[model samples]
Target chain A: MTAYSATVTVRLKEGVLDPEAETTQRALERLGFELDSLSSADQFEIELDADSEERARERVTEMTERLLANPTLHDYEVSLQQR
Target chain B: MTAYSATVTVRLKEGVLDPEAETTQRALERLGFELDSLSSADQFEIELDADSEERARERVTEMTERLLANPTLHDYEVSLQQR
Candidate 1:
């Protein structure tokens, strides 16, 4: 088995409204930072041992689909690296 | 002013305990996926108009320092791109 790390980035779907990100944007503007819009995402980095990089990403993708991200409201991307 | 986007990534500082990540890791293990460690992060992408890329990053760094991330327990990175 080879050590690997997978990074899964989850974000609200394009049509989904994100109140928290909006709130954060307003806070930044209140603090004098100039920004037009803001979007937020959650990133999960998982370390595991797998026979190949493909296997590692496959498992991590399953994890994202199952628990890390909500399919109805979110979209996710997975990137893998050998460690 | 030119359109730009800044992505700020925030993650727990080393030595700090991350219960949510731990719980997620455990859940993955329960589902038969083997992993060594897990970590989580928040990413904020801000779209704005700025005089220059440097100026944009400056404001976004302020945003990260003030509201997007808590410096006491989190470490953050900033990346900028022109739109």
Candidate 2:
């Protein structure tokens, strides 16, 4: 098995209300930073041992589907690097 | 001014405790997914008008320093794309 690092980024589906982003934008404006809009996302990095790159991707994808992201509200992408 | 999109990724500094990631790792293990370790981060995407790419990056960097991340515990990177 080879060590692999996977990054899963979870984003709110477009049209979903993102209160955290809105609150952050408000805070930035208060600090005199100008921005039209802001959106926030969560990314998780995992280190694991897998047979190949495809296996690493598959495992991480399943992890997102099962625990890292909510399919109903989140859209997630997984990327892997051999380590 | 040009429309710009900035992505800022904030990660915990080395040795910082990340309870969220630990909980996620445990949950994944419970579901039969094996991993050596896991870490979580926050990413912010900002849409704004800026005079140049440098300006856009600067504004978002300030945003991270001021509101998006706690400097004592987190490190952040800012990247910009013209939109």
Candidate 3:
């Protein structure tokens, strides 16, 4: 089996209210920084053994669908590379 | 002025403990998914107006160092692009 590393990025869907990003923006402005807007996301890096890159992607995709991301609230992207 | 987007990714420092990721890994395992390990990070996308790309990078770097990441416990990366 080959070892693969998958990077899954989960982001809130557009038009959704992101309180965390709003808070971060306010904090930056309080520190004298200027910005139009800000958004935040969660990224998960998974290292696992798979027979092929396709299998690794499939497994990680399933993981994201089942646990890492909420279908209603998040849009996630998965990228993979050999470790 | 031009619009810029900065993506700042903050991750736990190597050797640091990540309970959230550990919990996530166990949850995935409970669902019959197998993985060697999992790590998690936070990513912030900041949109702002800047005079130049260099200025955008500088501001985002400061934001990362001052607010987005804890220097003692987390490592961060900032990537910038025009919006």
Candidate 1 fraction of reference contacts recovered: 0.94
Question: Pick by DockQ: which candidate is best?
Answer: 3
* TM-score of the B chain in each candidate versus the native B chain: 0.97, 0.96, 0.96
Cα-based lDDT at residue A75, candidate 1: 95
Alpha carbon deviation, residue B30, candidate 1 (Å): 1.3
User: A1-62, model 1: which lDDT tens digit per residue?
Assistant: 99998889999999898998888888778887777899999998888999888888888888
Model 3 docking category: high
In DockQ, how does model 1 score against the reference complex?
0.88
lDDT (10s digit) by residue, model 1, range B1-83:
99998889999999999999999889988988778999999998889988888888888888788888899999999999999
Interface Cα RMSD, each model: 0.9, 0.8, 0.7
Lowest lDDT block of 10, candidate 3 chain B: B59-68
What fraction of correct interface contacts does each candidate retain?
0.94, 0.97, 0.97
Listed in order, each prediction's TM-score against the native is: 0.96, 0.97, 0.97
Q: Candidate 3 lDDT, tens digit per residue, B1-83?
A: 99999899999999999999999999999999999999999999999999999999999999899999999999999999999
Candidate order by lDDT, decreasing, is 3, 2, 1
Worst 10 residues of 1 chain B by lDDT: B59-68
Runs with alpha carbons beyond 4 Å of true place in candidate 3: none
* Model 3 lDDT tens row, A1-79: 9999999999999988998789889999999999998999999999999999999999999999999999999999999
Task: At residue A30, give the lDDT of candidate 2.
Answer: 88
Q: Which stretch of 10 consecutive residues in model 2 chain B shows the poorest summed lDDT?
A: B55-64
